[model samples]
Target: MESVALNPATLSGPVWVVAPHPDDEALGCGALLAALVAQGTEVWALLLTDGGFSHPGSRTYPRVRLAALRLEEWRRGLQVLGISPERSAALGLPDGALAAVPPEQVTAAVRRAFQLAPPALVLLPWQRDPHPDHRAAWEPVRAAWNTPVLGYSVWLTGRGAAADWPVAAEAQVLTFDVTPHRRTKAAAIAAHRSQLGLIQDDPSGFTLSAEMVDRALTGPELYFRPYGQSVD
Candidate 1:
């Protein structure tokens, strides 16, 4: 039962999640986030991208309007999972353009998220995810490694996406098994209707490309402390 943090404090106060995109939240830690909210955690989700590249027909739609639509998708999705709009932020960064962003801008965003969140446990994508968004999303919250940084995998499955970050940092990896609550998790994911058109068009196309999605989450959750405090 060491899979999830059983302490009520496990979900207490101001929790922040840095997602590569809107669906990452639901796919990565939907159950945990829901469980935390069910226990009363003030959760904030900082979505890094607008998911602009997802629609093959996006070229026909105004980028700004498309961005706005995706933001709404996230809004509805979070609501289904119990997260308020005030608790969520959509940066709307250009999709597939993260690696091209200026370093200053990336650092500034990360610095701001922490300043605003002051999170007890900052959640982010497991560094090894295949999606570039997942990799680039690291820009903003990476420095918070000094605090408790929990890496959630939406790509790698069997046991969650494995963390590729060096073990020289003070980071923790926790896995939440949502099999019992898969319906809630899946419903939360379905809230992103605009973004899931491929699956919407064909539900059978739901592939776990993120790598973290295939790793079955276990009970009590799994936590890995990366740096082990030696770095500090």
Candidate 2:
């Protein structure tokens, strides 16, 4: 059998979430993290790659500068979620160039992250995401599989086919109720002012007004458990 990176674990376990971008953490697993925090379970947020080129046509904010700007966005978002710097890591792979990065390079990053956290449960964006970067975030994490991985949703943007997403084979847990956490997640996403243009190019300023609706109407939170008897 081809070796997978993550291992399987119980549903309720110390968790680590891997995100392709800054806001995806909230869009994909905000509630899950909030729920875990409420339960006093340790949680870590792993940002797989830097998101520097979100607004593809923006001449003012080129790669290097954009990376720095996005890092600030990440820090602000983490602060809103109360995720400590000690518990989170940002892997600065080239922005908009996930496809260009070698698989080994990405896997090495995952290995280093796992060595630091060794989480019993992992959260990730499913494979179905249209963005190459979102999908790119999955590879190394999947290759480092000594533990169980729980795939989360973001690219579905809450409006696509809910089944057979490009998620990894190990993904078993699917979907979790959002409830009150929905608003909290939206508030956190609003922290990323630089990247809002990617969403709609509104330039109307960063606020919860736009993203808040996406969280409630389109999707709540989704997860996939990739291990044990969980698979159907």
Candidate 3:
């Protein structure tokens, strides 16, 4: 696992960020997105799921309302990262059931995205992430496009040791020094109010645990190159 700083200049083409859920993009690549946008790189975030099931047991907020709230939260959060609503989209796929979406549908969506602008890099959740939805998000995209990818981690960081990391033996780890954009990243993350203990009444409501947020904000953001070419 080799570490290196992100050189924004190297990212000269359009970039696509595939988030399994709304907040994953911000938590995993908030600083990266801010840095890329500063370099004038064309960037887009495609949220694969509606994030409606974060608090699945809640009777007060039905799935439809919850999905709508999450979408709005995502828009506001992206704006903080310097991406306009026009540059981002939600596939409207059901939350927590990405594996059930027709294989062809996922492929077609990705293919269509390429038509708008072929990405020089596609950022996705690491394949070995503990969250089922995170891992499921990768399969279709993996099968759909041969485009270069750098899988960012959200759930894997909890392992807390290099030896325990769930990655291919040959995978190259790239670390981006996001110190300059740390505050921006935090602000972007905070924009997702619904995910950060904002809903207090429901015991089942989702909350990004403070420990995870601390780890994310502590240092350089890491990305995994599972195979083939390196983005560096």
Candidate 1 Cα errors over 4 Å, as ranges = 1-12, 58-62, 144-146, 158-173, 198-225, 229-232
lDDT per residue as tens, model 3, 79-128: 99999998886788889898888878987887776666677789998877
Q: Estimate each model's TM-score.
A: 0.75, 0.79, 0.92
Task: Give the 10-residue window scoring lowest on summed lDDT in candidate 2.
Answer: 1-10
lDDT of 1 by residue, 25-128 (tens): 78777777787788777888888777766653444445566567768878887888788887777666777788777756776776676677676667777666
Candidate 3 has an lDDT of: 0.82
List of clashing residue pairs for candidate 3: none
Give candidate 3 regions above 4 Å deviation.
Answer: 159-168
Q: Is candidate 1 or 3 superior in TM-score? A: 3
Q: Sorted on TM-score, highest at the top, how do the candidates line up?
A: 3, 2, 1
Candidate 1 displacement at residue 129 in angstroms? 1.3
Model 3 scores a TM of 0.92
lDDT of each: 0.63, 0.67, 0.82
From the highest lDDT down, the ranking of the candidates is: 3, 2, 1
